[model samples]
Structure formats: structure tokens, C-alpha cells
Target: MLIGYTRVSTDDQHLDNQRSALRAAGCQRIYEEKISGAKRARPELNKLLDHMREGDVLVATRLDRLALATRDLLELAEILNRAGVGLRSLGEPWADTTSPSGKMVLTVFSGIAEFERSLIAERTTAGRLAAKSKGIRFGRPPKLSAEQIALGHRLSSEGTSVREVARMLNCHHATLYRAIGTYITPADSN
Candidate 1:
């Protein structure tokens, strides 16, 4: 069985062309969807996958219509392979997983994709390290400054309630406690 999957990024786009192409390529059952390839959850695509069985081939008009990312495409191929199903793209004839040459091409492509991901991760780590070395801070800035922290400590020592001090400083009581290194006990509060 040659099952077909068709998708469009938006409702404005039509799936007619893809459907015709898949039909011409001998697709027995066609699943249509109007959703972005970037989205992870595609109901029609999932349904089509679920409907496929061993010895069946999933056909798409183009590789991009199936998945926008190389990782995603490779993952789908892996799932099909595990289930004894094959994947075929009319636009990218070399992407047919039913043939030996196509499988070899997919393997090579997956290796290249993995290498590209590793390179991206390495570059990101290096960029973050360089930024840190240049005194660039990440995450939220401290709510209380050094002077504010000192004032919080003094206020806590002087029998002011943690909540009162926090209210005066316009911060949370927990923030004031962290700044002062103490949580004023209820017995000590005025």
C-alpha cells in the first residue's frame, strides 16, 4: 500500500497539487492537513502514520511537506524503518527508503545532520563562555543592591519585621531575608 500525506503551512494554501502528485504516484490512501511543518503535533500526519503497517510505503509530494527540519525527517524515517515501513518523496526521488541507494543517502544525511548539530552546540557554548568572560551577566538581575542589603540587615537587627522591611524596600520578604542572611522570628517582630 502506498499511503500519502499532504500538508500546507496555512489554511490559505491548497493541498490539491500535492494530492494530485501523490495520486499520480499511485497513493492508495491520502491524508490531508493544513498546518505548519514547524509544529510538533500534526493530527492528520499522526493518523496516517498510525494507519500504516508493515510492507506499506508512506508517500509525500515533497520532503518539506513531511518535515521542515532534517532531524525531524530522519526521526520519521527511523520510526518507519523500525515498523518495517518505507518512506518516499516524489519531489526528492533519492529520499525513497524502499531502495538500497536511498537508505545509504539517508544514513549519510543523518550523519551530516548530527555533525551540524554538534557544531552548533559547540559554537553556542563558546559564545556563552566569551560573554561571561566579558562580565556579561545572564538571568534576572538581583532585586536588592549592596546598599539595600545593608539597610535590610540593619533594619532586621533593629527589631523591624522582615515583611515590614521588605514592604519599605518594595521587595519580597524572602528577598529581604536572603539579603540580610536571616529570617526575623515572629517573637522578635515588633
Candidate 2:
């Protein structure tokens, strides 16, 4: 079974090209949606995934149209691969997971993607460090005073939740979390 999944970001974005290409590619049952790929919840995508079975193949027009983020793309591929279901894309001939050669190609591509991400991370870290050397302060200015920090610690020492502390301080959860890396939680406070 060749199950095709087509997507359009907006109502104005035409899915004609994708639909036509998938049909030409011999897709019998096509599932489609017009929604943002950034959305974590896609009804049609979910349905397509749920419908896929072993020996069945999932088809898409392009990698980007299929997944919003690289992590999401890889995760979806991992799921399909583990389920013995194949994923094929029209835009990337080398990304066809339906054939042995396609599988090899995809393996190589994954290596390349990992290498690229590492290089990008190194470049970004170097750039940030270089700018900081010239007296460019990174991250947000400290909004919490010593008294507030002490209050947070005191409340945290008690039974107050981190959420309550954050709400009282008008700070992000991560900000307070990083500030107090491993504080005694309710379970650990005893």
C-alpha cells in the first residue's frame, strides 16, 4: 500500500503540484491537509501515521513538506523504519526508504546532516564567544534581586512549587531553574 501524505501551509498555498506528482507516482490512497507544519498536532498526518502498517509505504512530495523540523523528520523516519514501513519522497530520489539503495542513500544523508549540524553548532558557539570577548554581554539582564533570590530559596525550601515561585517573580521557568540547578524539591526536601 502506497499511502501519500500531502500538505499545504496555508489555504492559499496550492497542493495541486504535490497531489499531481503523488498521483503520477502511483499513490492510490492520498491523505492531505492545509495546516502549518510548525503545529505539533496535525489531524491528517496523525491519521496517515496511524493507518500505516508493515509492508506499506508512506509517500511525500518533499522532506520539508513532510516535516517541519529536522528532528521531527528523523523521528518520523525512525518510526516508519522500525515499523517495517517505507517512506518515499519525490523531491529527494536518494531519500526513498522503500528500496535497499534508497536506504543506503538515506543513511549517508543522515551522516551528512549530523556533520552539518555539528559544524553549525561550532560556528555559533565560536561566534558568541568571540563577541563576548569584546565586552558584549550575552543573555538577559538579571531581574531578580538578592532578596528575591533568597525568598525563592526560602519558599523552595518549603512546600511551594517552582511554578508558584516563578509566577510570583514574573520570570520564566528556565530562568529560575538554571539559577537553582538542583534545589531540594518537595520529594527531596525531606
Candidate 3:
């Protein structure tokens, strides 16, 4: 028996591709869901897992569609492995659990996914550092400019409290404070 599982992260995501592929693969029973991969509340997926029997094969369009975390994949695979069930992924050429070589392939696939994730993290960190060196701010732009900042400093120095300065500037006190914090020189504050 071949059972298929299809998942879409959002309702807007189309399941046509997965369903078509699974149908072509001769899956008699198809389970589907429109929920986030990050969530653990997949009743359909759970039911499918519970319904699988020995000699049954579970099929999915992609390994990622089945589980978001590597731990999740491992746990699910362990369940299937223990139950004498098999898993087949249409997208992953190596994810066929019917043969010894395929089992080795799944192990290697997990390692590659882990390595790829680490490389992505490293590249993201390097990109952030590069942007910082070039003085390109990463987050949201500051509300105040140099002129407003200078005015905020001057107003605060002239015995005007933060509250008064913010009221006069028609902005929030926190915004004014943050703007002031950006330009406050250590020696000048002393």
C-alpha cells in the first residue's frame, strides 16, 4: 500500500503539484493539510502516520513538506523504521527507504541539509558584517535626521527636559530619547 502526504504552508499555497506527483506515484490514500510546517498541530499528518502498517510505504512530494526540523524528520523516520514502514520522497532522489543504499542516502541527506544550513548561517553573518563595514544600516531607518538630532541636543542642553523637547517636536519621548542617544558625545555628557 502507498500512502501520500501533501502539505502547504499557507492556504494560499497550491497543493496541485504535490497531489499530481503523488497520484502519479500510485498512492491510493492521500492525506493533505494547509498549515505551517513549523506547527506540530497537523491532525491529518498524525493520522496518516498512525494509519500506516507494515509493508506500507509513505510518500511525500518533498522531505521539507513532511517536517520542518531535522529532529522531527528523524523522529518520524524512527517511527516508520520501527513499524517496518517505508518512506519515499519525490523531491529527494536519495529518500527511498526500500533498499540499504537508499537508507544510506537518507542519512547522507540529513548531513547535507545540516551542512547547508550552517553554511547559510555563516554567509548571513558575513553579509551583516560586510554591510556594517560599509555603514549601511540593516534595520529600520531612524525617524530623525542630523538636523532634528542637533536640535534635540540644543533643546535638551538649554534646560529643556526630555518631555518638553518631545512635546515641542510633536513626537514620542522614546523617539526623542533614542535620537538623542545616537548623537550624545561622552565628553559632552560629562
Of the candidates shown, which would achieve the greatest TM-score relative to the real structure?
Answer: 1
Q: Output the TM-score of candidate 2.
A: 0.60
- 1-190: candidate 3 lDDT, tens digit per residue: 9999999989899999899999999999999999998887799999998899999999999999989988688768878999999998989867889878889977786687778879999999999999999988978887777777788888898889988988888788899988888786646778
Runs in model 1 deviating more than 4 A are 10-13, 38-41, 50-56, 79-85, 181-190
In order of TM-score, best first, we have 1, 2, 3
Q: Write the per-residue lDDT of candidate 1 for residues 1-190, one digit (tens) a residue.
A: 9999999999999988998998999998999999999997999999998999999999998999989988999989999999999999998999999999999999999899889999999999999999999999999998998778778888878999989999999999998888777434444776
Tell me, what's the RMSD of every candidate?
5.7, 8.6, 7.0
- Which sections of candidate 3 miss by over 4 Å? 107-190
Measured against the true structure, the TM-scores of the candidates, in listed sequence, are 0.76, 0.60, 0.56
Model 2 misplaced regions, further than 4 Å: 112-190
Model 3 poorest 10 in a row by lDDT: 180-189
lDDT per residue for candidate 2 within 38-109, as digits (tens), equals 887899989998989999999999988888787678778888999999999999887889889999977876
Ranking of predictions according to lDDT: 1, 3, 2
Candidate 2 at 116: error in angstroms? 6.5
- Model 1 alpha-carbon miss at residue 129, Å: 0.9
Task: Kindly indicate the candidate among 2 and 3 with the higher TM-score.
Answer: 2
